[model samples]
Target: MSQLSETTDGHLLKAITDACDGRIIQMPGPMAVTGVYPERSPPFKTIKLKGIEEFLLASARIGNRQPIILKLTPMDAVDYEAIEIESNKITQFEALEKHLVDHLGGYFNLLLGEAGADGLDAPYIASGHSLNAAITIFRREVEPLLARIKATRLAKAEQAAALAYADNDDWGTW
Candidate 1:
Protein backbone atom coordinates (compact mmCIF):
# COMPACT_ATOMS: atom_id res chain seq x y z
CA MET A 1 0.00 0.00 0.00
CA SER A 2 1.35 3.39 -0.95
CA GLN A 3 1.29 5.73 2.01
CA LEU A 4 0.61 9.47 1.91
CA SER A 5 4.33 10.01 2.43
CA GLU A 6 4.91 8.59 -1.03
CA THR A 7 3.60 11.84 -2.49
CA THR A 8 6.63 13.79 -1.42
CA ASP A 9 8.19 16.24 -3.89
CA GLY A 10 11.13 13.96 -4.61
CA HIS A 11 8.78 11.07 -5.30
CA LEU A 12 6.64 13.18 -7.60
CA LEU A 13 9.74 14.44 -9.42
CA LYS A 14 11.01 10.92 -9.84
CA ALA A 15 7.65 9.77 -11.13
CA ILE A 16 7.52 12.59 -13.67
CA THR A 17 11.08 12.02 -14.82
CA ASP A 18 10.52 8.30 -15.13
CA ALA A 19 7.30 8.87 -17.02
CA CYS A 20 9.12 11.07 -19.53
CA ASP A 21 11.95 8.56 -19.80
CA GLY A 22 14.30 11.13 -18.17
CA ARG A 23 13.36 13.77 -20.70
CA ILE A 24 12.09 15.99 -17.90
CA ILE A 25 14.88 17.89 -16.18
CA GLN A 26 14.70 19.96 -13.02
CA MET A 27 15.13 23.63 -13.69
CA PRO A 28 18.08 25.20 -11.95
CA GLY A 29 17.85 28.03 -9.38
CA PRO A 30 14.82 28.62 -7.16
CA MET A 31 12.16 28.07 -9.80
CA ALA A 32 9.51 25.46 -9.16
CA VAL A 33 9.11 24.37 -12.79
CA THR A 34 10.73 21.58 -14.79
CA GLY A 35 11.79 21.37 -18.43
CA VAL A 36 10.67 18.78 -20.96
CA TYR A 37 12.47 18.40 -24.24
CA PRO A 38 13.93 15.87 -26.63
CA GLU A 39 17.20 14.15 -25.80
CA ARG A 40 18.92 15.31 -28.97
CA SER A 41 17.69 18.78 -29.93
CA PRO A 42 15.87 21.42 -27.89
CA PRO A 43 13.43 24.19 -28.81
CA PHE A 44 12.38 21.77 -31.54
CA LYS A 45 10.40 19.80 -28.99
CA THR A 46 10.53 21.86 -25.85
CA ILE A 47 7.94 22.27 -23.15
CA LYS A 48 8.22 24.90 -20.47
CA LEU A 49 6.23 24.92 -17.22
CA LYS A 50 4.87 28.18 -15.91
CA GLY A 51 2.33 29.42 -13.40
CA ILE A 52 -0.47 31.81 -14.17
CA GLU A 53 -2.33 32.66 -10.96
CA GLU A 54 -3.91 29.37 -9.83
CA PHE A 55 -3.00 27.50 -13.02
CA LEU A 56 0.03 25.82 -14.51
CA LEU A 57 0.88 26.73 -18.07
CA ALA A 58 2.57 24.22 -20.35
CA SER A 59 4.06 26.02 -23.34
CA ALA A 60 5.55 23.78 -25.98
CA ARG A 61 7.69 24.93 -28.88
CA ILE A 62 7.70 22.37 -31.65
CA GLY A 63 9.68 24.40 -34.17
CA ASN A 64 11.16 27.91 -34.47
CA ARG A 65 7.70 29.45 -34.28
CA GLN A 66 5.54 30.32 -31.27
CA PRO A 67 4.38 27.89 -28.64
CA ILE A 68 1.33 25.75 -28.10
CA ILE A 69 0.02 26.57 -24.65
CA LEU A 70 -2.10 24.51 -22.26
CA LYS A 71 -3.35 25.60 -18.87
CA LEU A 72 -4.15 23.33 -15.95
CA THR A 73 -4.57 23.50 -12.20
CA PRO A 74 -3.82 21.04 -9.44
CA MET A 75 -7.54 20.48 -9.05
CA ASP A 76 -7.54 19.28 -12.64
CA ALA A 77 -5.40 16.35 -11.58
CA VAL A 78 -5.73 15.97 -7.80
CA ASP A 79 -8.78 15.34 -5.66
CA TYR A 80 -8.96 17.45 -2.49
CA GLU A 81 -10.77 14.79 -0.47
CA ALA A 82 -8.28 12.11 -1.53
CA ILE A 83 -5.22 13.69 0.07
CA GLU A 84 -4.44 14.57 3.70
CA ILE A 85 -1.65 16.07 5.77
CA GLU A 86 -0.53 15.57 9.34
CA SER A 87 -0.86 19.28 9.96
CA ASN A 88 -3.76 21.37 8.70
CA LYS A 89 -4.58 19.45 5.54
CA ILE A 90 -6.28 22.27 3.70
CA THR A 91 -3.39 24.58 4.39
CA GLN A 92 -0.94 21.98 3.11
CA PHE A 93 -2.92 21.52 -0.09
CA GLU A 94 -3.07 25.27 -0.61
CA ALA A 95 0.66 25.50 -0.04
CA LEU A 96 1.38 22.79 -2.60
CA GLU A 97 -0.87 24.51 -5.11
CA LYS A 98 0.79 27.84 -4.48
CA HIS A 99 4.22 26.29 -4.71
CA LEU A 100 3.49 24.88 -8.15
CA VAL A 101 2.03 28.19 -9.32
CA ASP A 102 4.94 30.17 -7.97
CA HIS A 103 7.38 27.77 -9.56
CA LEU A 104 5.82 28.37 -12.93
CA GLY A 105 5.68 32.16 -12.49
CA GLY A 106 9.25 32.77 -13.58
CA TYR A 107 8.90 30.72 -16.72
CA PHE A 108 5.52 32.26 -17.46
CA ASN A 109 7.05 35.70 -17.24
CA LEU A 110 9.65 34.72 -19.79
CA LEU A 111 7.13 33.12 -22.14
CA LEU A 112 4.40 35.77 -22.10
CA GLY A 113 6.42 38.97 -21.59
CA GLU A 114 6.10 41.49 -18.80
CA ALA A 115 2.68 42.81 -19.83
CA GLY A 116 1.21 39.33 -20.09
CA ALA A 117 2.82 38.34 -16.84
CA ASP A 118 1.06 41.20 -15.02
CA GLY A 119 -2.28 40.12 -16.45
CA LEU A 120 -2.09 36.38 -16.03
CA ASP A 121 -5.85 35.99 -16.03
CA ALA A 122 -5.95 37.26 -19.61
CA PRO A 123 -6.47 34.61 -22.26
CA TYR A 124 -3.30 33.48 -24.04
CA ILE A 125 -2.96 33.80 -27.79
CA ALA A 126 -1.26 30.67 -29.07
CA SER A 127 -0.21 31.12 -32.70
CA GLY A 128 1.21 27.89 -33.93
CA HIS A 129 0.18 24.50 -35.23
CA SER A 130 -2.86 23.34 -33.29
CA LEU A 131 -3.32 19.68 -32.38
CA ASN A 132 0.30 19.06 -33.28
CA ALA A 133 2.96 16.77 -31.87
CA ALA A 134 3.43 18.77 -28.67
CA ILE A 135 -0.20 18.64 -27.70
CA THR A 136 -0.22 14.99 -28.63
CA ILE A 137 2.65 14.33 -26.27
CA PHE A 138 0.89 16.25 -23.51
CA ARG A 139 -2.33 14.39 -24.01
CA ARG A 140 -0.73 10.97 -24.34
CA GLU A 141 2.11 11.37 -21.84
CA VAL A 142 1.47 14.07 -19.26
CA GLU A 143 -2.28 13.90 -18.73
CA PRO A 144 -2.45 10.16 -18.15
CA LEU A 145 0.46 10.33 -15.70
CA LEU A 146 -1.38 12.96 -13.69
CA ALA A 147 -4.55 10.87 -13.70
CA ARG A 148 -2.59 7.86 -12.51
CA ILE A 149 -1.11 9.85 -9.65
CA LYS A 150 -4.54 11.06 -8.66
CA ALA A 151 -5.88 7.52 -8.81
CA THR A 152 -3.10 6.30 -6.54
CA ARG A 153 -3.84 9.03 -4.04
CA LEU A 154 -7.56 8.40 -4.23
CA ALA A 155 -7.13 4.67 -3.70
CA LYS A 156 -4.94 5.22 -0.66
CA ALA A 157 -7.42 7.66 0.81
CA GLU A 158 -10.34 5.29 0.20
CA GLN A 159 -8.50 2.42 1.84
CA ALA A 160 -7.71 4.54 4.86
CA ALA A 161 -11.32 5.67 5.11
CA ALA A 162 -12.61 2.09 4.93
CA LEU A 163 -10.24 1.01 7.70
CA ALA A 164 -11.19 3.93 9.91
CA TYR A 165 -14.91 3.25 9.51
CA ALA A 166 -14.66 -0.54 9.70
CA ASP A 167 -15.41 -0.64 13.45
CA ASN A 168 -18.10 2.00 13.42
CA ASP A 169 -21.70 0.88 14.24
CA ASP A 170 -23.42 4.18 13.44
CA TRP A 171 -24.56 3.22 9.98
CA GLY A 172 -27.52 0.95 9.40
CA THR A 173 -27.81 -1.56 6.53
CA TRP A 174 -27.80 0.09 3.12
Candidate 2:
Protein backbone atom coordinates (compact mmCIF):
# COMPACT_ATOMS: atom_id res chain seq x y z
CA MET A 1 0.00 0.00 0.00
CA SER A 2 1.12 3.57 -0.66
CA GLN A 3 2.15 5.64 2.34
CA LEU A 4 -0.44 8.12 3.62
CA SER A 5 0.28 11.80 4.11
CA GLU A 6 -1.38 14.06 6.68
CA THR A 7 -1.12 17.18 4.55
CA THR A 8 -4.07 18.23 2.40
CA ASP A 9 -3.68 20.56 -0.58
CA GLY A 10 -5.61 22.66 -3.10
CA HIS A 11 -5.57 20.05 -5.88
CA LEU A 12 -7.17 17.51 -3.57
CA LEU A 13 -9.73 20.13 -2.58
CA LYS A 14 -10.30 20.84 -6.25
CA ALA A 15 -10.84 17.15 -6.98
CA ILE A 16 -13.33 16.82 -4.12
CA THR A 17 -15.17 19.93 -5.24
CA ASP A 18 -15.24 18.52 -8.72
CA ALA A 19 -16.84 15.33 -7.44
CA CYS A 20 -19.30 17.35 -5.36
CA ASP A 21 -20.21 19.41 -8.39
CA GLY A 22 -20.94 16.12 -10.13
CA ARG A 23 -23.54 15.57 -7.43
CA ILE A 24 -25.36 18.61 -8.75
CA ILE A 25 -24.81 18.14 -12.48
CA GLN A 26 -26.01 14.57 -12.85
CA MET A 27 -29.00 14.13 -10.54
CA PRO A 28 -30.83 11.22 -12.14
CA GLY A 29 -28.92 8.63 -10.08
CA PRO A 30 -25.15 8.77 -9.91
CA MET A 31 -23.30 12.12 -9.65
CA ALA A 32 -21.06 13.49 -12.39
CA VAL A 33 -17.47 14.63 -11.71
CA THR A 34 -17.04 18.33 -12.38
CA GLY A 35 -14.57 21.06 -11.47
CA VAL A 36 -11.93 23.63 -12.63
CA TYR A 37 -10.52 21.62 -15.52
CA PRO A 38 -8.65 22.38 -18.68
CA GLU A 39 -9.93 25.62 -20.18
CA ARG A 40 -9.05 24.23 -23.60
CA SER A 41 -8.60 20.72 -24.86
CA PRO A 42 -5.61 19.68 -26.92
CA PRO A 43 -5.71 16.77 -29.33
CA PHE A 44 -3.87 13.61 -28.24
CA LYS A 45 -3.52 14.98 -24.72
CA THR A 46 -3.53 12.57 -21.79
CA ILE A 47 -5.96 13.49 -19.02
CA LYS A 48 -3.88 13.26 -15.87
CA LEU A 49 -3.93 15.34 -12.68
CA LYS A 50 -1.10 17.60 -13.80
CA GLY A 51 -0.75 20.18 -16.64
CA ILE A 52 -3.97 22.02 -15.83
CA GLU A 53 -4.93 25.70 -15.71
CA GLU A 54 -6.72 27.12 -12.68
CA PHE A 55 -7.28 30.67 -14.00
CA LEU A 56 -9.93 29.74 -16.53
CA LEU A 57 -11.89 27.89 -13.86
CA ALA A 58 -14.36 26.24 -16.17
CA SER A 59 -16.68 23.33 -15.35
CA ALA A 60 -15.38 20.35 -17.27
CA ARG A 61 -16.94 16.89 -17.60
CA ILE A 62 -13.74 14.88 -17.51
CA GLY A 63 -15.30 11.43 -17.64
CA ASN A 64 -18.51 9.48 -17.19
CA ARG A 65 -19.19 7.32 -14.16
CA GLN A 66 -21.40 4.49 -12.90
CA PRO A 67 -20.20 5.48 -9.44
CA ILE A 68 -18.18 8.57 -8.55
CA ILE A 69 -14.41 8.10 -8.45
CA LEU A 70 -12.13 10.77 -6.92
CA LYS A 71 -8.53 10.25 -8.13
CA LEU A 72 -5.84 12.39 -6.56
CA THR A 73 -2.38 12.14 -8.15
CA PRO A 74 0.18 12.10 -5.29
CA MET A 75 0.98 15.12 -3.18
CA ASP A 76 4.26 13.65 -1.98
CA ALA A 77 6.22 14.66 -5.09
CA VAL A 78 4.50 18.05 -4.94
CA ASP A 79 4.60 18.20 -8.72
CA TYR A 80 1.79 18.33 -11.36
CA GLU A 81 1.45 21.91 -12.67
CA ALA A 82 -1.39 23.24 -14.81
CA ILE A 83 -1.00 25.27 -17.98
CA GLU A 84 -2.90 28.36 -19.10
CA ILE A 85 -3.13 30.49 -22.22
CA GLU A 86 -2.00 34.01 -21.40
CA SER A 87 -1.84 36.79 -24.02
CA ASN A 88 -2.02 34.30 -26.85
CA LYS A 89 0.78 32.31 -25.23
CA ILE A 90 0.95 29.14 -23.16
CA THR A 91 1.88 29.67 -19.52
CA GLN A 92 2.19 27.10 -16.74
CA PHE A 93 0.80 27.45 -13.20
CA GLU A 94 2.03 25.81 -10.00
CA ALA A 95 -0.62 26.71 -7.46
CA LEU A 96 -2.29 23.31 -6.98
CA GLU A 97 -0.59 20.34 -5.37
CA LYS A 98 0.04 17.11 -7.28
CA HIS A 99 -2.44 14.97 -5.38
CA LEU A 100 -5.00 15.65 -2.69
CA VAL A 101 -7.18 12.56 -2.21
CA ASP A 102 -8.37 9.41 -3.89
CA HIS A 103 -11.67 8.44 -2.37
CA LEU A 104 -14.13 6.00 -4.00
CA GLY A 105 -17.41 5.97 -2.13
CA GLY A 106 -21.13 6.04 -2.77
CA TYR A 107 -22.99 9.34 -3.36
CA PHE A 108 -26.55 8.01 -3.73
CA ASN A 109 -28.23 9.19 -0.52
CA LEU A 110 -29.31 12.33 -2.36
CA LEU A 111 -32.25 10.49 -3.89
CA LEU A 112 -33.19 8.83 -0.61
CA GLY A 113 -35.81 9.75 1.95
CA GLU A 114 -34.00 10.97 5.07
CA ALA A 115 -30.68 10.91 6.84
CA GLY A 116 -29.70 8.76 9.82
CA ALA A 117 -28.30 10.32 12.98
CA ASP A 118 -24.93 8.90 12.03
CA GLY A 119 -24.70 11.45 9.15
CA LEU A 120 -23.78 8.64 6.73
CA ASP A 121 -27.45 8.06 5.99
CA ALA A 122 -27.38 11.16 3.79
CA PRO A 123 -25.38 11.90 0.69
CA TYR A 124 -21.67 12.49 1.15
CA ILE A 125 -21.40 15.11 -1.59
CA ALA A 126 -21.70 18.74 -0.55
CA SER A 127 -24.14 21.14 -2.23
CA GLY A 128 -22.28 24.19 -3.51
CA HIS A 129 -21.87 26.30 -6.67
CA SER A 130 -18.41 27.70 -6.11
CA LEU A 131 -15.02 26.13 -5.46
CA ASN A 132 -14.67 27.47 -1.92
CA ALA A 133 -18.22 26.44 -1.19
CA ALA A 134 -17.44 22.93 -2.32
CA ILE A 135 -14.36 22.85 -0.12
CA THR A 136 -16.31 24.00 2.92
CA ILE A 137 -18.99 21.41 2.36
CA PHE A 138 -16.45 18.67 1.72
CA ARG A 139 -14.56 19.59 4.89
CA ARG A 140 -17.73 19.48 6.94
CA GLU A 141 -18.54 15.96 5.75
CA VAL A 142 -14.97 14.79 6.44
CA GLU A 143 -14.51 16.63 9.75
CA PRO A 144 -15.79 13.66 11.72
CA LEU A 145 -13.12 11.36 10.29
CA LEU A 146 -10.48 14.01 10.86
CA ALA A 147 -11.54 14.43 14.46
CA ARG A 148 -11.41 10.67 14.92
CA ILE A 149 -7.83 10.64 13.68
CA LYS A 150 -6.77 13.50 15.92
CA ALA A 151 -8.48 11.92 18.91
CA THR A 152 -7.00 8.50 18.39
CA ARG A 153 -3.48 9.60 17.35
CA LEU A 154 -2.99 6.04 16.22
CA ALA A 155 -3.24 4.61 12.72
CA LYS A 156 -4.77 1.41 14.01
CA ALA A 157 -7.64 3.26 15.70
CA GLU A 158 -8.35 5.32 12.62
CA GLN A 159 -8.29 2.21 10.43
CA ALA A 160 -10.69 0.36 12.69
CA ALA A 161 -13.10 3.27 12.83
CA ALA A 162 -13.03 3.67 9.08
CA LEU A 163 -13.63 -0.02 8.49
CA ALA A 164 -16.49 -0.06 10.99
CA TYR A 165 -18.22 2.85 9.27
CA ALA A 166 -17.18 1.82 5.78
CA ASP A 167 -20.54 0.57 4.57
CA ASN A 168 -22.82 3.50 5.36
CA ASP A 169 -25.04 3.00 2.34
CA ASP A 170 -28.21 0.93 2.48
CA TRP A 171 -29.05 0.86 -1.21
CA GLY A 172 -28.54 -1.72 -3.89
CA THR A 173 -30.66 -2.87 -6.82
CA TRP A 174 -32.42 -6.06 -5.86
Candidate 3:
Protein backbone atom coordinates (compact mmCIF):
# COMPACT_ATOMS: atom_id res chain seq x y z
CA MET A 1 0.00 0.00 0.00
CA SER A 2 1.70 3.14 -1.19
CA GLN A 3 1.17 6.21 0.96
CA LEU A 4 -0.36 9.26 -0.63
CA SER A 5 1.33 12.64 -0.28
CA GLU A 6 -0.38 16.00 -0.11
CA THR A 7 1.67 17.61 -2.85
CA THR A 8 1.58 14.57 -5.14
CA ASP A 9 -2.18 14.15 -5.31
CA GLY A 10 -2.02 10.44 -4.40
CA HIS A 11 1.24 10.00 -6.35
CA LEU A 12 -0.38 11.09 -9.60
CA LEU A 13 1.82 14.16 -9.90
CA LYS A 14 4.92 12.15 -9.09
CA ALA A 15 4.00 9.52 -11.69
CA ILE A 16 3.56 12.16 -14.37
CA THR A 17 6.58 14.26 -13.51
CA ASP A 18 8.85 11.23 -13.21
CA ALA A 19 7.61 9.86 -16.51
CA CYS A 20 8.19 13.09 -18.43
CA ASP A 21 11.30 14.25 -16.56
CA GLY A 22 9.42 17.45 -15.81
CA ARG A 23 9.25 19.64 -12.76
CA ILE A 24 6.17 20.81 -10.97
CA ILE A 25 5.34 24.52 -11.06
CA GLN A 26 4.18 25.76 -7.70
CA MET A 27 0.85 27.55 -7.82
CA PRO A 28 -1.76 28.61 -5.37
CA GLY A 29 -5.04 26.75 -4.88
CA PRO A 30 -5.69 23.20 -6.00
CA MET A 31 -4.32 23.49 -9.52
CA ALA A 32 -1.20 21.48 -10.35
CA VAL A 33 0.96 21.93 -13.44
CA THR A 34 4.02 20.20 -14.93
CA GLY A 35 6.23 21.49 -17.71
CA VAL A 36 8.28 19.20 -19.91
CA TYR A 37 10.24 19.50 -23.10
CA PRO A 38 9.76 16.36 -25.12
CA GLU A 39 12.54 17.37 -27.45
CA ARG A 40 14.47 19.30 -24.83
CA SER A 41 13.71 22.54 -26.70
CA PRO A 42 11.46 25.55 -26.66
CA PRO A 43 7.66 25.61 -26.67
CA PHE A 44 7.52 22.79 -24.18
CA LYS A 45 4.54 20.70 -23.13
CA THR A 46 2.41 21.52 -20.16
CA ILE A 47 0.13 19.15 -18.31
CA LYS A 48 -2.34 20.84 -15.98
CA LEU A 49 -5.00 19.80 -13.53
CA LYS A 50 -7.47 21.99 -11.68
CA GLY A 51 -8.47 20.37 -8.43
CA ILE A 52 -9.15 16.64 -8.59
CA GLU A 53 -10.71 16.60 -11.98
CA GLU A 54 -11.31 13.37 -13.80
CA PHE A 55 -8.86 14.29 -16.55
CA LEU A 56 -5.56 16.09 -17.04
CA LEU A 57 -5.07 18.61 -19.84
CA ALA A 58 -1.86 18.48 -21.89
CA SER A 59 -0.69 20.78 -24.65
CA ALA A 60 2.38 21.50 -26.70
CA ARG A 61 3.47 23.43 -29.77
CA ILE A 62 4.86 21.58 -32.78
CA GLY A 63 7.69 23.49 -34.46
CA ASN A 64 6.88 26.25 -32.00
CA ARG A 65 3.62 26.71 -33.87
CA GLN A 66 0.07 25.40 -33.80
CA PRO A 67 -0.63 24.30 -30.25
CA ILE A 68 -1.80 20.72 -29.93
CA ILE A 69 -3.58 19.56 -26.82
CA LEU A 70 -5.10 16.40 -25.38
CA LYS A 71 -6.75 15.10 -22.27
CA LEU A 72 -5.68 12.06 -20.24
CA THR A 73 -7.35 10.45 -17.28
CA PRO A 74 -5.42 8.10 -15.08
CA MET A 75 -6.73 4.64 -14.45
CA ASP A 76 -8.45 4.35 -11.10
CA ALA A 77 -6.75 2.50 -8.28
CA VAL A 78 -9.13 -0.42 -8.73
CA ASP A 79 -8.22 -0.58 -12.42
CA TYR A 80 -4.53 -0.56 -11.55
CA GLU A 81 -5.05 -3.38 -9.08
CA ALA A 82 -6.95 -5.35 -11.70
CA ILE A 83 -4.21 -4.76 -14.24
CA GLU A 84 -1.59 -5.76 -11.67
CA ILE A 85 -3.42 -8.96 -10.89
CA GLU A 86 -3.86 -9.81 -14.54
CA SER A 87 -0.23 -9.06 -15.25
CA ASN A 88 0.83 -11.21 -12.34
CA LYS A 89 -1.34 -14.02 -13.64
CA ILE A 90 0.58 -13.73 -16.91
CA THR A 91 3.93 -13.48 -15.08
CA GLN A 92 4.43 -9.89 -16.29
CA PHE A 93 3.71 -8.02 -13.10
CA GLU A 94 7.22 -6.61 -12.98
CA ALA A 95 6.59 -4.51 -16.08
CA LEU A 96 3.08 -3.38 -15.28
CA GLU A 97 4.17 -0.15 -13.58
CA LYS A 98 6.42 0.66 -16.49
CA HIS A 99 3.47 0.42 -18.84
CA LEU A 100 1.62 2.97 -16.74
CA VAL A 101 4.65 5.25 -16.88
CA ASP A 102 4.87 4.82 -20.62
CA HIS A 103 1.37 6.18 -20.97
CA LEU A 104 2.64 9.69 -20.10
CA GLY A 105 5.50 9.32 -22.53
CA GLY A 106 3.03 8.26 -25.22
CA TYR A 107 0.93 11.34 -24.48
CA PHE A 108 3.97 13.54 -24.95
CA ASN A 109 4.60 11.88 -28.29
CA LEU A 110 1.03 12.52 -29.38
CA LEU A 111 1.63 16.27 -29.19
CA LEU A 112 4.55 16.02 -31.62
CA GLY A 113 2.63 15.14 -34.82
CA GLU A 114 2.60 11.45 -34.01
CA ALA A 115 -1.19 11.46 -34.45
CA GLY A 116 -3.74 13.39 -36.44
CA ALA A 117 -6.44 15.62 -35.03
CA ASP A 118 -9.27 16.37 -37.45
CA GLY A 119 -13.05 16.61 -37.58
CA LEU A 120 -13.02 17.16 -33.84
CA ASP A 121 -16.19 18.62 -32.44
CA ALA A 122 -16.00 22.03 -30.81
CA PRO A 123 -18.65 22.33 -28.16
CA TYR A 124 -16.70 24.65 -25.91
CA ILE A 125 -14.66 27.71 -26.67
CA ALA A 126 -15.44 28.31 -30.34
CA SER A 127 -11.99 29.72 -30.96
CA GLY A 128 -8.52 28.26 -30.28
CA HIS A 129 -7.87 24.71 -31.56
CA SER A 130 -6.83 23.39 -28.19
CA LEU A 131 -10.19 22.21 -26.87
CA ASN A 132 -11.23 20.51 -30.08
CA ALA A 133 -8.01 18.60 -30.54
CA ALA A 134 -7.95 17.69 -26.88
CA ILE A 135 -11.49 16.34 -26.99
CA THR A 136 -10.77 14.47 -30.20
CA ILE A 137 -7.79 12.59 -28.85
CA PHE A 138 -9.60 11.92 -25.64
CA ARG A 139 -12.52 10.37 -27.50
CA ARG A 140 -10.52 8.53 -30.12
CA GLU A 141 -7.82 7.07 -27.88
CA VAL A 142 -8.21 7.71 -24.18
CA GLU A 143 -11.85 6.76 -23.92
CA PRO A 144 -11.41 3.29 -25.38
CA LEU A 145 -8.45 2.58 -23.16
CA LEU A 146 -10.48 3.66 -20.16
CA ALA A 147 -13.31 1.41 -21.26
CA ARG A 148 -10.98 -1.56 -21.56
CA ILE A 149 -9.57 -0.91 -18.10
CA LYS A 150 -13.09 -0.63 -16.75
CA ALA A 151 -14.00 -3.96 -18.31
CA THR A 152 -11.00 -5.58 -16.71
CA ARG A 153 -11.97 -4.10 -13.33
CA LEU A 154 -15.53 -5.33 -13.65
CA ALA A 155 -14.43 -8.80 -14.70
CA LYS A 156 -12.13 -9.02 -11.71
CA ALA A 157 -14.91 -8.04 -9.37
CA GLU A 158 -17.26 -10.60 -10.91
CA GLN A 159 -14.68 -13.34 -10.66
CA ALA A 160 -14.03 -12.55 -7.02
CA ALA A 161 -17.75 -12.63 -6.27
CA ALA A 162 -18.11 -15.96 -8.01
CA LEU A 163 -15.21 -17.42 -6.08
CA ALA A 164 -16.62 -16.22 -2.81
CA TYR A 165 -19.96 -17.81 -3.61
CA ALA A 166 -18.28 -21.05 -4.53
CA ASP A 167 -16.44 -21.12 -1.21
CA ASN A 168 -19.59 -20.47 0.80
CA ASP A 169 -20.57 -23.88 2.25
CA ASP A 170 -24.21 -22.80 2.63
CA TRP A 171 -24.44 -21.12 -0.77
CA GLY A 172 -27.38 -23.24 -1.92
CA THR A 173 -28.90 -23.91 1.45
CA TRP A 174 -32.06 -21.93 0.87
* Candidate number achieving the greatest TM-score relative to the actual structure: 3
* Cα lDDT tens digits for candidate 2, 91-140: 11112211111221222132121222245564354331233333344445
Q: Which pairs clash (backbone N, Cα, C closer than 3 Å) in model 3?
A: none
Query: Which order, best to worst by lDDT?
Result: 3, 1, 2
Q: Please provide, for model 3 over 51-169, each residue's C-alpha lDDT reduced to its tens digit, 9 standing for 90 to 100.
A: 34332222222111222212232433412111001111212222323433355334433432222233253222122223324324433444334344446667888999888888688
lDDT of 3: 0.33
lDDT of 1 by residue, 27-75 (tens): 1222232223234343122223243213332222112232222222233
TM-score of each: 0.21, 0.26, 0.27
Model 2 Cα RMSD, 1 decimal: 16.3
CA lDDT of each prediction against the hidden true structure: 0.32, 0.30, 0.33
- Off-target runs (Cα >4 Å) in candidate 2 are 1-4, 7-117, 120-123, 126-128, 150-174
Lowest summed lDDT window (length 10), candidate 3? 81-90
TM-score of 3: 0.27
Top-lDDT structure, candidate number? 3
Provide the global lDDT of candidate 2 against the true structure. Answer: 0.30
User: By descending TM-score, how would the candidates be arranged?
Assistant: 3, 2, 1
